[model samples]
Target: MNNLTPERRKGRKYDQVLEGARQAFLQDGFDGAGVDDIARNAGVSKATLYSYFPDKRLLFIEIARLECKRQGDEAKSIMPQNLPVRDMLSFIATRMVSFFNSSLSLSIFRLCVAEAERFPDLAQEFYRNGPLMAQTKLGAYLREATERGELNVEHPEFAANQFAELCKAGIFARLAFGVDKRISPQESSFVAAEAVEMFLARYGVTQD
Candidate 1:
């Protein structure tokens, strides 16, 4: 769902270029990753690389979009639907925290923010594919839980956003700004548990 033309996307080297670009962007960030390096890493000539992805920005954004989709799908596949509501919420929160603190995630967020003004479309695409997609998925789960009498959420969308922000609480900003080098498992667990508690306090169904 990127800007790649149909003919360009049909070429055999398309996936090769994308994989190479993914590695380069992850290691060097958007501005630091050179086209020559990307082509070399892909084992393709510059002409072939350019034929598939004419713009580096499009290549970067496409990688981010694909990564987001892959993560979303993985989460859906691994998350147990039969778990108790509290356990399920905790699982979601813990996973969210872990992903937020990942190096790849941090790099993508920094790149999107740094180049947002110059490449507004890049940032917008990342947002839609990343945060917006996550929120939508969470909202759907909240609605399902509410139907099952597990949560008393009136507005699933707002509650989903709140839960996501809560997952990020203390750790995300620190990591994003380079204030904290890394988040320990203990810290990550604490944040995830606390997020679940706070969210349940607000939205969980209370027995009379």
Candidate 2:
């Protein structure tokens, strides 16, 4: 379980600690980041940092949660709802692929998996905030589109998961496994386009 409580989060240095810890984790990974370095980066003393986060794992989990929330909020704010189904799906696929290909996202995923056994809640929190959140949002849109006669999806949640996997088809595995250091724009675009097409082929409404 996470050690961070609502009361602890109310501390003035909470955000500062989190930001500093995020940088350290990004640079040195979970095991490599030290409490002293994190405190120094945040311009706070070790005691101040420890007061907010009793365990380093709790700090990492909180960072992941907040980052996921930020990304999810940004996606919701900018995603256009008035576009045609194909266009909307294309937009979603592109965004998903880009996020999946990012170094920070990959690192978070790797860390979650690596710590799953010892810290199962960490992986659960990541899933709830990341993949499950995306799926739920996409499912709602798909359901609305289906009601508007723009799509034929019977199971929007399942379809959303499928489309997400399709968007990850080529670049995700390669990057996650170190087969590729970076995903070129062309590769990401191609994957997104293909995912949109394949998804539309299955669920798009036919017009005579």
List residue ranges in candidate 1 displaced over 4 A: 1-59
Report the C-alpha lDDT of model 2 over 95-185, residue by residue, as the tens digit.
9998888766777798789877876776777788789989999999999999999999999999999999999997888978879767899
TM-score of 1: 0.74
lDDT of 1: 0.83
The residue-by-residue lDDT of candidate 1 on 43-137, one tens digit each, is: 99999988878888767767877877787677567867689889989988988998887766787788789877866666777687678877988
How does residue 35 of candidate 1 score in lDDT?
99
TM-score of 2: 0.77
Clashes of each: 0, 0
Q: What is the lDDT of residue 16 in candidate 1?
A: 92
Among all windows of 10 consecutive residues in model 2, the one with the lowest summed lDDT is 1-10
